[model samples]
Target: MHGKRVLLIVSGGIAAYKSLELIRLLTQAGCGVRCVLTEGGAQFVTPLSLQALSGEPVHTTLWSLTDESEMGHIALSRSADLVVVCPASADILARMAQGLASDIATTLLLATDTPVLVAPAMNVRMWQHAATRANMATLRDRGIHVVGPDDGIMACNEFGPGRLAEPPVILATIASLLAREPVPQDLAGRHALVTAGPTHEPIDPVRYIANRSSGRQGYAIAAALSARGAGVTLVSGPVSLPAPPGVALVPVETASDMLAACEAALPADIAVLAAAVGDWRVTHPGTAKLKKRPGQPAAPLSLTVNPDILASLSAPGPRRPALVIGFAAETEDLLANAADKRRRKGCDWIVANDVSLPGDGSPGVMGGDRNQVHLVTADGTEAWPSLDKREVADRLAARIAAHLAPHSLIRNSP
Candidate 1:
């Protein structure tokens, strides 16, 4: 990163303030920073401020007579090792998706072939809007990298994702992308199956049982596996996250659906069951909404055990994956329970974490980005320090690669 050059595009939104910090981090890391500020972005932060931090002229217009005389936009676009869109507003994303060159920022984006990354920031509604979703999907399909719009409350007083990711997270992503080597082909001929999010067990048409899983970890794992040249199929439960690029997505609702999907994806080289599947479901769910009785105690509902997806996939059979991994999300006895679960479920490994709420009552790993997990295997347990979910995914994928290397396993085992 020391000699890297970054073209930073600042777009509108309250998150535009974060771009300043990002610039500082980039420069302090010895990277050359050049900024292109959109008109909407100027409303949140001034060009002078960006210039002060970048130690360079901030380009805010496409029609500068002196600047265009030297084809500045083209230079700026091609000069960087990477291009990052911080607080990528809905408007800019749409423009990029539609190939709109109406502004200098989009014009540069359109002209450059440099690797691009976007951190979206908008109202939660806008972020979830069908149009925005489509645009993001299109961008991802075109090979653009997306960091995050973390889940949280926003300046608009609305909650449930759309906040710009913290500067450190964005910076780490940038570092990962910039320092990345040629895509590793260690798992090129292999196939991977990954499960994510929380299963929704319906008690009625209007009510359901679920857990607080944002699906970030699972999605990151899928992305990591794909990056390592493995074909990935992600069987996802109900989650707000977008599908990772290069991974096939099979969305399901209940535990049974997820199990069916996983079985259908059989013969995989690896399987990582990261979904927080419900242990039980209503024995007999009501066909319609269950009405409340006037001033009476609530009706008791019966529950039955759901299918054990992990155990089913881990069964000893020719079609079983060479390596099956399960996740143990526990509140107590993290290692003890995780080790027992690995043995009982017959999985090759267990990734365990304590999802209990912190003493300060802040959000925990269930819905947060960072995690501290222990890798439990037949030999021993290795505790990993807290890290971003993507980092965790990279480390886990690397371990899988090592485990599957030639001579690591008996490929012909029954």
Candidate 2:
């Protein structure tokens, strides 16, 4: 990131405090940073603080005579290699999507030719609103980059995804965006099949069994592979996450549907089984919603084993992928269980992680955006430090690219 210039747009949101740390990180990385604070943003952080860290004056208004005389809005917009909106409020994002230039921030965003990255932060309801989703999709389609609004408890005493991405995540994303050359297209001509989210097994028309998997990791992996030039087929269960750009998405509800989708996507170069598939489903599901009788005990439901997707994919066959990877979300004996699973399922590698919660009441891996995983392969187990799921996905995708490179020629041969 050295010598790179970033125009940091701080928007109004509780997460605006994080922009201070973001500026510090950028400056320390030898990148020049200039901040533009919106009216809402000014409520959370002072311009002096940003100016002191950036060693440059802050741009707060569109009509500042002295500032505009020196550097006009047009010049400011084109000055940076990248423009980043940290704590991008729902309002600002909506304005950007609609090409509304009601404020200096929006005007500059419209004027800039530089690539844009936005990190959204808002209430869970607002984040999940149909309008917000549509706006974000529009931005993504337009080639803008988005980092995250990670899931967790918020200042409003609510729990769910809407928090700003941690500072480190923002920093890493900035570095990647500002790189001189395009990201390596190492997976070109390779087909990647990935399954994500928690499969729901129906017990009745209105009831089902499911797990806590949020599908963030799997979605990130799909995005990473696609970014590296792979044709990705994502067989995803019901997850709130949006479909990654440039990937084919097959949405399924039950384990059976997920398995069928994976099979249909086969002859793939690589297969990543990341879904938390249900082990058992109702043997005889009710045709309609089950009813309760006042004097009757709860009706006993018979269960049957669901199809083993990972094992099936790893089965010896000509249609088998060159590399098969599975994820083990264990709460105890993480390494041992993962190793056993790898061997038992006949997969090439297993990414294992302890999803147990600490005594301090922190979130667990089942639904969070961060993970600490152990890569168990034939040679040995490699422990990776805690990282954002996106970073982990990038690292795993790189590894997959390297592993599949040797077989690319054979696969592509006429």
Q: Which residue runs does candidate 1 get wrong by more than 4 Å?
A: 1-3, 10-32, 39-57, 62-79, 84-103, 106-177, 359-364, 407-414
lDDT of each: 0.89, 0.89
Looking at model 1, residue 17 earns an lDDT score of 99
Per residue, candidate 1 scores C-alpha lDDT tens digits across 1-414 of 899999999999889999999999999999899999999999999999999999999999999999999998998899999999998999999999999999899999999989999999999899888788768756764567888889899998899879999998999989999998876778777889999999999999999999988787888899989989888999999986678878999999999999999998877889999999999999999999999989989978999999999999999999789899999998998999999999999999999999895732122357765688999999999999877677788899999998888633333211
Best by lDDT: 1
Where does candidate 2 clash, by residue pair?
none
Tens-place lDDT per residue, model 2, 325-388, is: 9999899999999999999999999999888956221333587646889999999999988776
In candidate 2, how many Å is residue 352 off? 0.9
Q: After superposition, how far is residue 373 of candidate 2 from its true place, in Å?
A: 0.7
lDDT of model 2, residue 129? 85
lDDT of 2: 0.89
